[model samples]
Target: MPKAQETVLEIDLKALKHNFQYLKSKLQPSTKFLAVVKAFGYGSDACKIAKYLETLHVDYFAVAYINEGIALRKAGIKTPILVLHPQAVNFKALIENCLEPSLYNAKILKEFITATSIENQKNYPVHIKFNTGLNRLGFWHNDINFINKTLSLTKTITVKSIFSHLAASEDLNEKPFTTNQIKDFKTIAKNFEKTVGYKPMLHICNTSGILNYPEAHLDMVRSGIGLYGFGNSEIENKNLKPIASLKTIISQIHLIEKGESVGYNRAYKSDGLQKTATLPIGHADGIGRQYGNGKGYVIIKGQKAPIVGNVCMDMIMVNITDIDCKEGDEVILFDANTTAEDLAETANTISYEVITAVSQRIKRTFIE
Candidate 1:
């Protein structure tokens, strides 16, 4: 590992494996597990994460875009890949790379059929997405006829799986809505299966869906945040190990008198004698300016140093008055103990944004 880099993301593969085992234990032996490795494996490394999951016998991999699947293929990933949001322009590349596209809309469904027919491919894998409740992607339950018509009209494409997304599986307050989504999905799956004359793999649960509604596991379960060591509830969080930790070094320190200001726009002014430390990380590295002022904090040698002043594009200032810290000391932006969830809560955001926001420029060191 290159310790020379000022800011680095440490990925513990062991912790990731532990999380995988814990999640797998929640599923039936027949149910498949698809690991979501989008956003550069949640800003760690897609190839590395996928490689690890492949060994654990993860049934499938889901990426947000086609390019991610292609990158994994180039890296020699043999497991089938599901592209959640596919575009017409990449339909050609999708087939050429053997990446399965999740056909949601009629246009994509028709276009993919045309593309595969031109290639004269038979039984090409494609996942049918149903819009259960998210209102984001997938076909409506009413569109089963359109889908059946399209499939019956051609042998160029095959139904690899039928899937849907749950919006509030983690929120108990929305259990009724979640239950309705499951009901709609099951009806759609059964209708589609009978209409198409083939039973495609069915899946609808995400991480929260896996934990909160296990019976709805269907044919498979997908996990993104959970695999990266985050749980929807406190009890689950304790059982999962955080896989990523953001660390940096205190580059410099300053001693200021009363009324002295620091950082751009004079966003912070010292009320009395104060000490501040600067770390080589900022909004550009995913630590946004909103986390500045007295909101976010960095752990320095077990002591909390609240951020002061505006977070710059490449640097941030933190008040370290009471801590016996110095230049070049180790600083933890967030770790297994303080987690991305805890840090994001302080900034009024979610863990997904916190980890994905970490700049790709930061070197990632994986612990085997």
Candidate 2:
């Protein structure tokens, strides 16, 4: 890739392919792969990422909302898409697009069934979500009987898969909790199959679960962060490549004398002669205000230039006094080398927040 003349998020298809293959290698031949392309493909371009993944023969695609699934359908994605948290209002639209919904609660299940019946649809696929431990969504274990009875009353909708979300599959200390969640999911599946008289696919593993719990990789595994070049641990990160690189160029250079202040509210005061370079990226571009005041730094000519002062809406100034750089020089906010994980650590957050927070306004260029 050439030097970036303006703020841009470069999505690397090669890296995505490598990550997908790497994750797939960990699964059994019988296991299926569901690529989670929600949150704009983790803040990259979802349509582009999904298109590339489709060529890789990803078994399925998962999105958080009906609109997201609709977007993929509009983008010509034909693979099965599971809407993880679809709303009742969009059940009609969801069915029209052939998007599966994860019915987590009685209310939603009832509404979706009504919608499907009204649409004169039969055996329309839908996923049943069980609340193993996430508490975010999904039905309780006791609801299995209710779900089965409800399903018995209608043939318009069929259970395509039964799934759950792991709360802390990434932390070893949470091993007990994660294993329990998996165990609970297995119990739920057994009861569900016995009640429903047939088995739908069972999947509960996310990216971290895929790495940390091989025993739980039941029928399929869902990967979001791992597909985006993060494995949620130092060891796994070495095997994966970050797919997005945020780059910008120096718009201006300034020389500040002692006692000179920079940015809003005079957040940064130079104690000595300092040189700073302004880059056309800031909070509006996902480099949040928390990264200011020497918390975060950008790479310039192989050197680290600390971000000084507060981050403005559309620009940030990095101290470049120790670096040999000039206006129009390429600046790396985060890349494979200076990763988003590394940058996120400076602000006490995770890589997901950093990457997904990247503003959609930023130009997204892909490396095919």
**Highest TM-score among the candidates is held by which one?**
2
- TM-score per prediction, in order, is 0.98, 0.99
- How far in Å is the alpha carbon of 131 misplaced in model 1? 0.7
- Tell me the tens digit of each residue's lDDT in model 1 across 1-368: 44424788999999999999999999999999999999999988999999999999999999999999999999999999999999988988999999999999999999899899888899999999999889998898889888888888898989989999999998999999999999999999999988878899999999999999987999999999999999888999999998999999999999999999999999999999999999999999999999999899999989889999999999999999999978988889888998899899998898899998999989888899
Candidate 2: C-alpha RMSD after superposition: 0.7
What overall lDDT goes with each candidate model?
0.93, 0.96
- Residue 10's lDDT within candidate 2 is 97
Q: Give the TM-score of candidate 1.
A: 0.98
Q: Clash totals for all models, in order?
A: 0, 0
lDDT of 2 by residue, 1-368 (tens): 69998999999999999999999999999999999999999999999999999999999999999999999999999999999999999998999999999999999999999999999999999999999888999999999889988999998999999999999999999999999999999999999999889999999999999999999999999999999999999999999999999999999999999999999999999999999999999899899999999999999999999999999999999999999888999999899999999999999999999999999999999998
**lDDT: worst 10-residue window of model 1:** 1-10
Name the TM-score of candidate 2. 0.99
Off by over 4 Å in 2: none
